[model samples]
Target: MFAVVLLAHGDVVRERKIAAHVMKGSVEIRSNHRELRARLREAGSVRDTAVEGIVERLDPLGPVCTGVIDGGVAFGVRVTVPYVILGPIPRETFETLDWPR
Candidate 1:
């Protein structure tokens, strides 16, 4: 599945807002042209399930809140396209990120 990562210069709320819009069918998550509404419903907390999973890896750095929207087709080729919102915190607060080494 494809992953959309939005890095904003604003606060956490902005990140959440973008995530919400992307998740709520506002922004197109993928070009596959499949409706992700059903997968999202089955995933329970989209934010917690997808976004938080990524955020957990960044916890050691600082406080970074996340939101996610699922996108993909079902059947045997089911994929969970994740829309990730990254909150910007103080540089000093984070010693390092889970970015590429």
Candidate 2:
């Protein structure tokens, strides 16, 4: 199973909505930062400080941030499997029950 960590600049409701949209194929996987921020703000107020903090924490983890916003609507989404802590593992490992390289 793949775990997806979705970070957004809004409340939990907004985050979940975006996650659902992403999962349902309604929202494109690669969305512009501006668009995302706008959508997030629709749910609630988004703080720049909070967005920056999340970005700083997730950037090292190889999470990709959309670059369509003016450094305001920054966030990340990380998909990984549970129980593995070494980093992103191979899909084949999970399928075959083999050790991840």
Q: List per-prediction Cα lDDT, in the order shown.
A: 0.42, 0.40
Number of clashing residue pairs, candidate 1: 0
Name the runs in model 2 displaced over 4 angstroms. 1-46, 67-101
Q: How much is 72 displaced in model 1, in angstroms?
A: 19
Q: Write the per-residue lDDT of candidate 1 for residues 1-101, one digit (tens) a residue.
A: 12246422111112213443334433443432344444544544653455566766655544554543334332212334344534455565544435576
TM-score, model 1 to reference: 0.30
The estimated TM-scores of all candidates read 0.30, 0.24
Candidate achieving the largest TM-score: 1
**TM-score, predicted candidate 2 vs. hidden true structure:** 0.24
Per-residue lDDT tens digits for candidate 2, residues 3-73, read: 33433332222333355434443254344545755665663434444445555654545433422122222
RMSD of 1: 13.4
